[model samples]
Target: MVASLLSARGLNKQFHSGNQPVSVLSNLSLSLEQGESLALTGRSGSGKSTLISILCGLEQPDSGRLTVLGEAFDGDAGRQTEARWASLRRQQIGVVFQEANLMPALSLLDNVRLRVRLAGQDEDGCRDWLERLGIGELAARYPDQVSGGQRQRAALAMVFAMKPALILADEPTGSLDRHTAEDVTGQLFDLQARYGCGLILATHDIELATRCNHHLDLGHQPEA
Candidate 1:
């Protein structure tokens, strides 16, 4: 049988708003196979980020079972060590945040090289990845010197350079204009397909969500 790249079951999460507890996720479950793309859509406060955080090991669910690349984390297993999660983030998972994911102090090329190095990948092709993302000429520029769209392109180059098994992108183009968003997301999908990596993208854009192989709307029940 082909092993799933990521799997989660019966996820539950809660948070306190003032004195009342709000249930953000209840018995949520999802899975991603290699080379598949899953889009997560929901309202602003819908637990989309929370779910991604849990999946990426940034946060633990109150109760659930998570398995990524064959490594398991049972909710009953208690809190996992930082090292364990760090190892996964470094080697198997590549995450792109909505903004400021690049190191402001480093030049674009250096940032990609650093990320690739951390993933234990060769840094030689870092420049090629940046060029593929359409930011090659800006390799020597710092993050603050580039436009928001360019910076995001650099971030994508960094993520793809690592050749991660699973990619979790949160609002990757939320700050860009319509045209730029389309351009960036188009490259994202194309590169993802070329790499044959699993992708889970959380976005508020309905049209963008539709491009993925599957869609999960947190506003309603998840589709089977």
Candidate 2:
């Protein structure tokens, strides 16, 4: 078997909602290898987003172990981890959030080119990704000027341009119309295959999950 590019062992996350402790993920474990794609499905409040947050290092687990490319996730050294993850994510991990999350002031090209700049990548890499994602024509348009579908496409371009090792998307199509959602999802998978990036997506769409290599029902866990 191929080595896993990312892994989580004994993953658990808990939060305080008033005086009660809400356990989100309990004893959950998952792994993904390069070029693999897995879809995670769970109903609302099933900890799907929480899990994604932890995996992306956006939030720390109360207790668990996370390893990316053999390196541990160190929240204590988050600045360092962010820098390293930012670099690795730039080189390997692509993320597509539910919202396009574009800056209204920036042009589509600049928005897509943001990570390339952060990663210190070259213009060729940025331009190539924009073209591949079918947004080269709108490169000069500002985010606010574009349609919702176009904005999502631009966001995908930005993430793809990073050429990350893994791609983590949280309900990337949730806000789109069926047609646009399908288009975005199609592009996401196409890029995943093309780039050989491991994909771990948290989605409520069952049909989307079926298209992946493996599917897991996170809501079925005994406790959450």
Candidate 3:
């Protein structure tokens, strides 16, 4: 049988606003296989980001079981150590945020190199990734010197350079213009397919969600 890349069961999360507790995620569960893409679609504040955070080990669910690349975490077992989660993120997961994902101090090439090095990948090919993403000319520029689209391209180069087993992109193109968003999305899907990695993209764009192998709407009823 083909092994799953990621899995979650009975996931539940809640937060407090003043004296009231609001449920963010309730009995949420899903899975992703290698080379498969799952688009998570939901309205804003519908637990999309929260789910991504939990999947990437950035936050713990109040109750659930999550397994990623053979690493398992259950509510009964408590949260994993910060060091452990950090290591997992550094080596196995690549996250692309809407903005501020790049290191402001480093040049674009250096940022990609750093991520590649962290994943035990060769740093020499970092430039190749940028070139593939059509940002080779901006390799030496700082994040602030580039346009939003170029910065996002650099982010993609960094993520792809890391050679992560799984990628979690939360509204990766949310801040870009429609044309720019489409370009970035195309490159993202192409590289994801070429790398044979698992991807979980959280966004409200229905057209974008339809491109993925599967789509899960968090606004709908959670599986029993």
Output the better candidate (1/2) by lDDT: 1
lDDT for position 70 in model 2? 72
Question: Positional deviation of 120 in candidate 2, in angstroms?
Answer: 2.5
lDDT per model vs. reference: 0.90, 0.82, 0.91
Judge candidate 2 at residue 157 and give its lDDT: 86
Q: Write the per-residue lDDT of candidate 1 for residues 1-224, one digit (tens) a residue.
A: 55589988988899999999998888888899999999999999998999999998888898889898888888644345556788999988999889949888999999999999999999999999989988899999999999999999999999999999999999999999989989999999999999999999999999999999988888785432
For 1-224, candidate 2 gives per-residue lDDT tens digits of: 67789888888888999999988789888888888888999889988888887887777887778898777884455578777665666666677788898888889888877776775667577767778777788889998888888889888888877667788899998889999999989999988898788899989999999999888788887553
* Residue 66 shift from truth in candidate 2, angstroms: 1.0
Top model number, lDDT: 3
Better of 1 and 3 by lDDT: 3
Mind giving the per-residue lDDT tens digits that candidate 3 earns over 1-224? 56699999989999999999999899988999999999999899999999999998888899989888888887543335556678889998999999848889999999999888888888989999999999999999999999999999999999989999999999999999999999999999999999999999999999999999999999895554
After superposing candidate 3 on the true structure, give the runs of residues whose Cα lies further than 4 Å from its correct spot.
76-80
